[model samples]
Target chain A: MAPLIGVVEFPGTNCERDVAHVLEILGGRAEILWHGESSVKGADAIVIPGGFAHGDYLRAGAIARFSPVMTAVAEFARGGGPVLGICNGFQVLTEAGLLPGALHKNSGLRFLCQEVALEVVGTDNIIGSRLEPGRVLHIPINHFEGSYVCSHDTLRNITESGQIVLRYVDNPNGSVGSIAAVANIEGNVVGMMPHPERASDVLLGSTDGIDVLGSLIDCLAGDTEPTPVDQGH
Target chain B: MRFDVKVEVRPRAGIADPEGATVGKALRALGFEGVGDSTTVHVGKLIEFDLEAPDVPTARDRVDAMCHTLLTNPVIEDYSFEVIPADSGSGD
Candidate 1:
């Protein structure tokens, strides 16, 4: 049986289908889990896909963080289950305290949508474990508040602890340290600005996303689980 | 008793404030006095809410929790608050 992946969709989340399609194609079964769901429906992994949750009214990911589904995501992460949050989903993760730091406005104060080259920096994560370190991958980023912000202490900790997973080659959005993705201390949960779903197929212009998503699929399928030392930290 | 609460949120010092910078630039372009390249500005949020609490201290504490939990992201922002009885003035 294909590992079931839960794709969480808040009211304004528009990428659930896209993410689900990609997951299904990647050898995982995807189930669209609504924000109101109190449980993750017994899925093996959870994904919070990109979109303007709650219209981004209070702030990106602010209101959505309060949704009941987040409770399950938090529990799953705590239990060492894999969880991935992309784009606005990343915003929601930080808002819910599942991930450190916050996503602020692009330093240029403009919405950005473009392809960016991401250099794999931390392989201690589910998504990064499948890729070679220092490898650059082409992925598309679409967001307004994708710049990562954290205190100096948080930066130092994540840097020393290998919590940073991906970085933009050109520092496109003024993210601190050019960080494009971050993982939790346990390395079970990761939040990334780039949309790996959008880069899943070569027909979509790039297959680099396969390496990212494929890494997670490998973990879900029981093909890979690296010890802390093997994570290459 | 009901209290009217106002919470102000701002990015912490040293954090980038591009929105505030853009506003500052606009002000300078409009020829506002005392505004210059060195004039540092940071835009923040003002959130007002009505709370039910027994007393002033209780109301303040509740608002503080709200700021910590939702109104602000402590990792990147700081917040302050003002509280008044809901009926103290005309908000109707």
Candidate 2:
């Protein structure tokens, strides 16, 4: 069966359609799950795409974490279902306690919107399973609060466990250890600041994200060693 | 009884506060005297809320829950609150 990927939609979410479209293009069925709802429609995988949910009022992802659908997302992740969060979604994940640490305003106090180079630092998780460690991916990140911060103990724990999945090649936002993406200790739930869905097409300037998205689908299909996607420059 | 609460949330020690740093830099650029390089500012949020509770302890507990669940991110922020009787004009 084709994997059913659910894209969550909050009131102010703007990237749900982009994620749904990209998932379909990658041979998966896509559905948009509403934030007010408390269920996930039995999706095989979940993607929380980027946007200023709830206007990022209290803080990025602070209010969104209380959305009704997030309870379902957390439950889904706890059941070992594949879950991916991008940009604003990443913030939501951390706020929801599905991931450790919190994202803060950029060190330069600027809302960065540009392509950044990322290195695959972890390969044990679903998102990085098929990609080679040290592979450079050029993906775009658009966010004001994207710098990830964590306690020293938490950093040491994640580093030792190989939970840090992606690292910024240029350290764009002052993330600790240059972390651009991370997974739960279980490696089933992943959160990343860079927009892999936005980078999935070559016409969009790079196809580097195909590997990330494809790896997700493969993991959902119960394939642990899926073939790597072509890394088109 | 009605209670007034003031919740202050700030980044924890050892965390970088870019917004605060930016404001401090601007203060120096604007020629604010005595704003030395050794001085640093940490910006934070002040949230005020009014609630009805039977007593001060109950009000404090409720406000504490609010800080833990919504007003602050414990991972990066530290929060404290003051609760006072709404009908009182001064401190206890």
Candidate 3:
């Protein structure tokens, strides 16, 4: 059976179809789960795609964290299921306490939409399992509030625990440690600001994103154990 | 009893407030001599809502919960609220 991936949709979410399309192209079944619904329908994996949920009012993802479906999503993540949050979804994960750190407005106070380079820093998580450390990939980021921030103590903890999964090559948003993505302590839940789904196709100017998404699919196929690319850090 | 609540939410101290800094820059650019270079600005949200509660204590408790749960994000923001009788005059 094809692995089923559930794409959650909030009121202002506009990336559900894009995510669903990409999953289907990757030979995985995708389902759109409405925010008003309380269940995830037994999905093999879940992807919370990017978009301006709740019009991004009161901060991005702040309002959407209370959606009925989020309860189930949290439950699914707590049970060790693979959950990927992209862009605004990343904000939602932090707002929901699934991930650490908070996303503030970009340091430049302007909306940034362009291709940015990312360095895979850790492969102990499901998202980076198939990629090599120090490898750079170009992915598009579009958001006004995408600067990740956390306390010094939290930063030290994340670094020591190998929870820092990806880092920005150029540090466009002034995130602490130039962090671009992170995984929860359990490593099953990952949240990133770049749109991997948008870059999965060759015609989209790059296919580098496929490796990340492919690793997710691989994890869903019962290959989720940590594969440390390099133990010297 | 009907009570009016005004909630003010702002980014916690030590966190960079880009929006507020932009506004401060704009103010300085407009030739506002009173705006000093050392001035720091913090931008936030003000939400006003009216609800029925038994008394002032209950209204404060409910509004505090509302702020914690939805009105403000505890991770990046701090919030405070003022509860008053709905029919009270604006002067008070």
Docking class of 2: high
Error of 2 at A152 (Å): 0.8
Question: Where does candidate 2 clash, by residue pair?
Answer: none
Question: Chain A in model 1: its TM-score?
Answer: 0.94
Candidate 1 chain A least-lDDT 10 residues: A224-233
Task: Kindly list the per-residue Cα lDDT of model 2 for residues A40-140, writing each as its tens digit.
Answer: 99899899999999999989999999999999999999999889999999999999999999999898888999999999988888787569998999999
Candidate 3 DockQ vs. native: 0.74
Candidate 3 A-chain TM?
A: 0.94
Which regions in candidate 2 have their CA more than 4 angstroms from the true location?
Answer: A223-233, B36-39, B90-92
Q: Per-residue lDDT for A128 in model 1? A: 72
Residue A31 accuracy (lDDT) in model 3:
96
The best candidate in terms of DockQ: 2
Candidate 1, superposed: residue stretches over 4 Å from native: A223-233, B36-39, B89-92
Model 3 per-residue lDDT tens digits across residues A115-225? 999999988887876799999999899888889999888999999999999999999988989999999998999999999888877788877777888788777766433
Q: Rate the local accuracy (lDDT) of all candidates.
A: 0.88, 0.88, 0.87
TM-score for each of the candidates: 0.93, 0.94, 0.93
Q: Taking the candidates in order, what DockQ does each have?
A: 0.83, 0.86, 0.74
True contacts kept of 2: 0.91
